[model samples]
Target chain A: MSTVVLLTLTGLGLAALYFLVASGLALVFGLADVLNFAHGLFLSVGAYGTWWASGNLPGAGASGWGFVLAVIFGVVCGTVVAALVELVLIRPLYSRTIEQVLVTVGLSLAGVALLQASWGADPRTYPRPQWTQELTEVAGARVPNDRFLLIGAAVIVLAGLLAFLKFTRIGLVIRAGVEDRSMVTALGIDVRRAFTLVFAIGGAAAALAGALGGVYAGSISPTGGSSLLIFGFIVVVIGGMGSVVGAAYAAVAVGLLQQFVNYTSPGLGDICVVALLAIVLLIRPQGITGKVATS
Target chain B: MLRIEGLSAWHGEAQVLRDVDLFVERGEVVTLCGRNGAGKTTLLRCVMGLHGNQTGAVHLDGDDITARKVHQRARRGLGWVPDDRGAYATLTVAEHLTLPPVVGPAPWSLEQVHEAFPALYTRRASPATKLSGGEQQMLALARVLRMGATVLLCDEPTEGLSPLLVQQVGEILRRAKALGVTVLLVEQNIHFATTVADRHYLLAEGRIVGHFDNTDIHSREADLLAHLGI
Candidate 1:
């Protein structure tokens, strides 16, 4: 019972991390119509940026404040990378939806190679800064403070994203664009600008998730990013592709379920995630949340 | 004003339009009338630069827009409200007005659109997908008016509206004409054409077969009916 409870909390915590990273990916694909294979690569970039900034700016007024600086740096790096990709690559591929994937896939491969070249292909740690190293007891269960912090941060991001999408002009335009790009453009707003902004926002969110996940898990690597990317893809598919709330729910469900299966059969744990995704897809071809309403 | 000359377009070589030539002066509410499959919609799409495979010289106030993108043409004062109204199915009526990119300051506002179509004001918060056909059409026109367009291309605006609402929509077109916005209207309803159009072009099999200006439609009713297959 204790094992299930502890592992479940761990799974949920990690699920929170996945939600933070993957929802942005799902949003970009659903709205911008970009395959964005480089999404996970951006997360890796965020983790590495955080690691570099924290070490270089060690005098960040204290460990927590240093952690804050690292996050800000990660977001900045990711946003810049995203905007550049949009301006340089994605903006040209609007009419050719099929080739959009080809370009992004090539980019993702290049990104992975770039990371390997820069960081030597080995796992690197974010050091679990002293402030987060301490453990805590919550509701009689022992939990790592950093994991809890990760969970809290994930929740906050989720809420903030929901509010932004629901209330903002850009968010409303994005929702409409997903329905009819021609109509949105005909209204005289440059849809190209919206696509670029969406990409940047998605990249920034995923970067933060990458930074947080690296610290929570204690390491990150070029190859390590592939697994997170695949997991995010699975979550998006099962939760309903392009659905922010759906991604969150699916992530938690898959995370906990995968962890439970891991206890029973570590090999099957991976299989379980794939199997669950397949089942969901077969039952709801549009995904669990189904197609974006585009309202 | 809008003008097209030697405009040719195709749907992968099936050729929907052939050297089509037409024009609409400012404040003109012109109708392109034809039976089913006469390329009326194709001509409109070509003028709007929406047909993927196309060749044409489309001019707006004497500016050549032959190769302009749809959005570029739109930004240059052209607005198209598709037959379907292109409702953002999940969006509210209020969102419908706000989501499209507005080109400039317009005489119309949310309040004016609401006043023009009071039924919309009553259901401003309702999902667009859930609105009645007439209500949907109203919201569609209202949405475009909010976008500050000088030229409006409305395809089959009254296709599915009630008779009374159809009359009301004609009034709306008259109102748009008074605002000096040029309109290229395509319709199947002869009564609608007779009531609203300043000029009429009868099309048959992707070709213009007959024409009648405002002062002359009465004399050419037979030719119009024969060409229109009405």
Candidate 2:
């Protein structure tokens, strides 16, 4: 029973990380129609940003409100980078699908290489609050407190994203744009602005995930985001491209399945995930929620 | 209040519109009549800035807007009701009605829109995809009217609608004209066009071939219908 409880909690923590990365990916793809391969780079930027701020920023440290400040800084950095990418790179190649994909793929590779050059290839110990490193007993099992933090953060992000989509004017434009972008523009709304906004939002969320993920794993590396990004892509595909709620559900399924299967056989978890993806594709090609533009 | 002078458009290597010139005065309802591939839809797309392979001058209220973007043209008081109705799958009816910014001075209020379109009012909370075809068409027209478009570029507004719904659409277009909205319509329904439009331009092979008022149309109704292949 304790083993089950521990596995469940751990799986949820992993799910939270996947949700953070996939939600942004879905939104960017849904609204902009740009398959942004550099999304992993955004996550890396966030993780590295938080790590750097904890040591270098005057008011930020590894614990308490200082850690919170560092996370904010990292998110802001990611947001700025995302917005810049949309303005400078993606905007110029609008409506050129192949070109956009190639540019993003090239950017992802170049971004990682740049990071490796600057920070070296070694994994660095991530600075986290002392409390997160400790554990709390739950259901006769010792569960890491970071699991709760990850779950809590994911819940908040999910709620916040839903509210943003539901109640805001930009949200309305985004929803409409996803359905028919040309129609939205015919209504006189500037959809390119919405594109930039989605990129920023996606960046912020991915960065938050990067920061939280480093804490969960106890270390951060330049390639860390790319590694998690593979799962992120799987989660997005399983959830449906552009649906946040779907991402959350798929993340939970993937994470839990991986945790349970990996426990039984050392390296079978990843293969199982691929099998699950194939089964899903064969059964429902549009994904669990269907690709209906952020619904 | 709207004019196009020497407009020419192309799709890659093939030219579609050729030196097209037309105008609609303030509060006038004009119809562009053509057969399939006669560049009617392409003309509307060019005016709305949706098509890029174009050259010539599009003047809205005597201001050259040839280089304006789609949103910019829309913001300049050109409301478009596309043939497809352009309803969103995710947005509700109310959201669709309220999505476009009010660019003109005499835009309809929510109360006015609700009074004008009671079906839309009842289905206000429903997603646009859930609405029937007639309802979607009505919602499309209502959305533009709510935005208070000074010049409406409506393409095939009555296509595929029932006789009853077509009458409703005609009534709405008449109401828009009464409210001082200039309209440039592309329609195959000649009987409906004569009832709502002041004048018509016959387009063939991408150029304006003939112009007629209601009386001229009534005299040459059969010939015009045969020409339009309707």
Candidate 3:
């Protein structure tokens, strides 16, 4: 019914965050070959950074540009953390995939702990501001106006990102690097610089995702990123790891599927979705989208 | 234009290359002809300075390039088209041609390379993975030419090309020699060496075993084959 349609729409609206976070992680993993477990921590930090900037900053960003200010702050904090992590940790373990996996996992845990201490364990509310409370009728159901904004924002962000990756110089280098690290470097590209930029970009996108997630969920806990991490992993797995477009498509499909489960079984909806994903893995080991093009 | 002295490389104590002494002057097409496991590719890699534990003195343009990064050497006019062709699967032939960071470029463009080898122009927009072996080799060559380097280290440039395409490659090399490009071509094709290379340095068990000029290689075919273990 109309409720199910609303739920599906809600899922689509949320797919924006998934696309942002997963695409960045996919690039990092694909290009740098780093399995970054600490990626989710950037989300929580981005959420907190947005909160601090929009909620506490002086009259500078307190006006109608609160949302934009929050997003910018999130991007900055995300990028800084990414650079720090790369310089301090990832640089040492470059090309050591197994060590990278272990270190990133440990770093991730440490990041969660750091967020818990900095922002506290209790969840924090992030209201979508007064202007965003407007309602719209979707399939005869009243939908929050902010949800429409979320959907629009996601589309805009994704389109802009796609354009950047397609048309820009660094973007072309990045895509090329993912295909063959050796060949790209041999062509006079500094692989290290590209790797750092890729990680920073991923961090920025994760931060943006956090900001969007704050508006959508109404509150974000310190551990908010953990669930996101899980969801991203599932989407990446199902979509075929290292594929940007595949992650986008898989996010929508998984989001809709999750919404359907919520409708079918309210209490065990999460479990139902997990079971469905398990079934998917059993059938398609390469995931729903299959492998990316190798060099 | 290039020199390596007492260069030794180890893949974590395996010691793949030992005291490898090699040199190539400007505008020279020298071949690192060698037997299997003779470290021909390793010598090319050493010149590129692509390994961390590689101990050597690599000099280019009369400067010690031993400490420089791989890309730095590349920018200093060392272009390497690896044996793998390095064909980025998703990238189009046009993108591959356009992506290399070309400096001081009074050289060929994609149009010119395509004019030289028309097959590339035909598949200009095609994904590189979809290209046939011959076309892929052409793409790699075109991509390197687009980089506008003075020296090219082509590791097995004619590995999997058809005979007709191989003939075309020999013509390309002849044209390249005319263009004043120094080619350190690592080739297995005897015909290619006889056709295009001015000099040959055969290697065995990671050391230079024999040297030959174009005429020496043609007349001493048995010695060349025996030295290369072909």
| Quality of model 2 by C-alpha lDDT | 0.92
List TM-score per model, in order: 0.94, 0.95, 0.90
When just chain B is superposed on the true chain B, each candidate scores a TM-score of 0.96, 0.98, 0.95
Task: Report the lDDT tens digits of candidate 1 across residue range A99-209.
Answer: 888888888888889989988888886656776767777566777777787778888888887777779988887777766777777676677778888888888888888
* Best-first order by lDDT: 2, 1, 3
lDDT per residue (tens digit) for residues A235-261 in model 2: 999998788888999999999999999
TM-score for model 3? 0.90
Error of 1 at A93 (Å): 2.6
Report the candidate with higher TM-score, 1 versus 2: 2
Better of 1 and 2 by DockQ: 2
Model 3: how far residue B10 lies from native, Å: 3.7
The TM-score between candidate 2 and the true structure equals: 0.95
Top DockQ prediction, candidate number: 2
Candidate 2 lDDT for residue B81: 94
User: Candidate 1, residues B171-200: lDDT per residue as tens digits?
Assistant: 998998888888999988987887888888
Global CA lDDT computed for model 3: 0.79
Candidate 1, clashing residue pairs?
A187-B101, A189-B101, A295-B90, A295-B91
